[model samples]
Every structure is written in structure tokens, then in C-alpha cells.
Target: RGFFTSNRDGGQGYDDIYKFLETKRLLCEQELYGEITDLETSALLPDAKVSLFDSRFNLVSVTNSDEKGNYSFNVECGKTYNVRAEKIEYTTKEQKVTVDDKRGKTHLPIALEKSTCKVAIGDDLGKCFGIKMIYFDLDKYDIRREAAFDLEKILDVLSQNPTMKLDIRSHTDSRQTFKYNEILSEKRAKSTINWLIKNGVDPSRLTGRGYGETQLVNQCADGVKCSEEEHQLNRRSEFIITGL
Candidate 1:
């Protein structure tokens, strides 16, 4: 549908809005909007940080939910975006949305589950986000970027509790000799402790050691053939609050 002005050379010499039907391209401004709420109660959540990321996980834009739990964004049509909503002590929720070519606004409501990180003395920050293992490349003990993010949860807890003491234990699968595994475990454990000390935690409150391959969460130890995932169950870092 399209329109043309008649005031230029017609009998009705006045500006007027006209309506017509035709096949033509028209520009459209696309928008995305929705509400953030609690998953358990369906209650509206306010002040939640809402972020949009592209397919590569690169951040595109960020916004916050208002007091009414409403958030919106100007978006492009025919593109997929990952919308994530997060708040402190709440489990972050992410959903992938593909905005179709159809015009107007798209509604994407998300609900966040409550986090299990209780900040108690026996809590394992590593397991708080449902990610139990902090993986290390074989023979590498340095903290990776993904590992750093996981460690931040522990750092946050320790920072809030000055008297908390952590026992950092690093373990490795039984792919190598016992002595070698023990040494590697110790190195990895110490590396974990060093990360905490380097960040802000006190040296006196942290103690670490490697358990070698002594503790296997599954039957993937020694020479038993197992999938890579089963082997990964044995390679993990355990951060426990031993004292508070």
C-alpha cells in the first residue's frame, strides 16, 4: 500500500492524508519487549539486569527491568539474539529468540530460578551454578577465563565473610602414574589457592592440596575404558569452607 499527495495539481488544493493499496516496500522499526519474573512464584522482578547477545555470545546491548518488571529493546528483524536476565543470588536465565520478518514487537518473557548458593560455611561455590568441575587442559594448572568466572563465586563469598577459611582441593583423572598425578594435583591445587590470594582473599584463611587420583567419582579410574565425560568427572576442583 502507498500514497500520493493531491494538493500539488488537483482540484482539492489542500494537504490531505490519503490511503491506497499497492505492492511496495516499507521500512519498519522492530522492537522486543517482555517481563522478568521469578520462576518459582511468578512474581515480577524489578531492577534485573537484562542483556542481549549475538550468536557469538558477544554482548549487543544491556537494559534493566523497571519497577514494573518491564524491559524493552530496539532490535533488528530476522536475527537471533540470546536474551539473558540476571540478578544477585538468582539463577541467571538465558533464552534464544529469532525475530521473524513479521513487523511489530516480539514478546519474550523470562523467569529466573533462585540460586542455591547459600553462603554457608559448607557450601561449595564451584557447585553453586550447577557446574561442579573447573576443567584444566591436560598438564596445565593455570586458571582459564571460564574457570575464573567460576572462582568469582567463591571470591564473592569469602569477601563477604572475613572469617571463612577455604580448603581448595584439585584432583586429576588416572591417566598418568600415581606420583605424576599427585604432583600435578598439588600444582593445580596450589594454583587455585594462588588465584584466590592474588585476587583479594587472605593467605591465612586458605589451605590447598591435591588429592591425586585417589578419589574417583565414577569407575573411570586406572585402565577402565570410559567416555571423555566419565573421565571428566574425576578431574575437578573442590573448594570447601573448612572454617568460619
Candidate 2:
């Protein structure tokens, strides 16, 4: 006699056990297990989606890697299968395996390379360099000694990428006359660029523009009264990536 389980109607529970004189034992499956990791660091990645597909390209099963980056699936013996692993911000990996007639388990591990942005055209150098703005005294257009620290970051990027080009945008608070502010901002922008040129940056890779009071960040325009902090926000400088 053999023991078996059935979920047929009128069963006392979800699955009821029964004794039978004739039955067939099932042993046509093999266990497949593996881990997912970062290609560069080899660090295990969790919650990565794992998929199994048959020889005909039909999806068989799907599972997610556990917190330990481990996943498993049961595949039929003598059948060829495809396995795929994927996660956000990483490249996907696909592999093929065959479960031989000999009953045994299979092990597979996949690593994915992280995605990166090599270069960005609209990237702001000031923000990238971790500085708010290059400092300049009132009515002055010369590069201050304090600004060197932040300016050096731009120099480094330009030196590393010789073919890269940048554009400088300068603005000032509405405390000064419109025309005067325009001229001062232009000088400030040029002064910022000149420092780069003096430090080995090519002049052809740099361009300067002065927006003056035209691009007031807040409502602190000519006739508007604003707090010192609010007005300070209007005074700024930006270096934008113009080309690769």
C-alpha cells in the first residue's frame, strides 16, 4: 500500500491523505539555486527579479531574490531552460542551463554591472562642485581669493575632459541700477572664466553671459522690498556644461 494526498471534493481538509494499493512515485524535477550580485563590488543584491523560461521561450516561473540575494526554482529533468536576473540601475543577465537525466541540483550565480551617466550636457558645475556661488564683493567683478576653492573643481573637470565646453551665467541683486548691474554681472562672469584660462583652461571652451536683474529669482525686482536673505538668493553664478 502507498500513501497519497488529494484535494478532491468532500475532503475533510484542504488536502487529505489516503492509502492506495497502486501509485506512482514522482521524481522528475531538479532544484536550481543561485545568487545575484554587483559586477564591480560583488555585493549581494536583494529583491532582484529572477525568471525561468522553457526551451520554447515561454515563461515558466518567476521569483525574487531574498534578502540574502538567493533564489531557487524547480525545473524538469532532460529539459533545457533559460534563467534571467534583473534589478533597477543595473544591467540584466540571462543564462541557459540543461537539467540532465541524472537527478541532481544545479547552481548558478549572476553579477550585474551598475549603470552610470558618463557625461551630462546640462549639468551645473556649481551644484556638482558642492558650492552655492562664487563670492564677489558689491559692485565688484574680480574673482575673490575665497572663490578659488570652488573654481578649482571646474578646472579639474575641464582638465580631465579637454574637449568639454562650459558657459558662465552671472546675476546680481536688485539693489543696484539695472544697467549698472548688467555691466557688473558681465565683468564678474568674464572674471570667473579668466581665472580658469589662467589656470590652463582653453578660452575657446568658455563663454560668459550676464543676466543682471532680468532673471530675478524671487519677486525682489526693482521696486520690490525684500529681506536680505531673499535678496541674497538673487545673487548667483552658474557654470553649465555646454558640450561634451
- Candidate No. with top lDDT: 1
Q: Cα lDDT of all candidates, in order?
A: 0.80, 0.79
Per-residue lDDT tens digits of candidate 2, residues 97-209? 88776678888888977845355888886565444577566677777544664575566557656888999999898887889999888987888888988989889999989
Q: Model 2 segments beyond 4 Å from truth?
A: 1-118
Q: What would the per-residue lDDT of candidate 1 be over residues 1-244, giving only the tens digit for each residue?
A: 7676666555465876677985676665568899999999999999998988776666789999999999999888878888878777676667899887877889999998887656566777556555346777677788876576556556655665678898988999899899999999999999988998999888999998999999988898787999887887777789877887
Q: Estimate TM-scores for all models.
A: 0.64, 0.49
Look at candidate 2 and tell me the lDDT of residue 100.
77
RMSD (Cα, Å) of model 1: 6.8
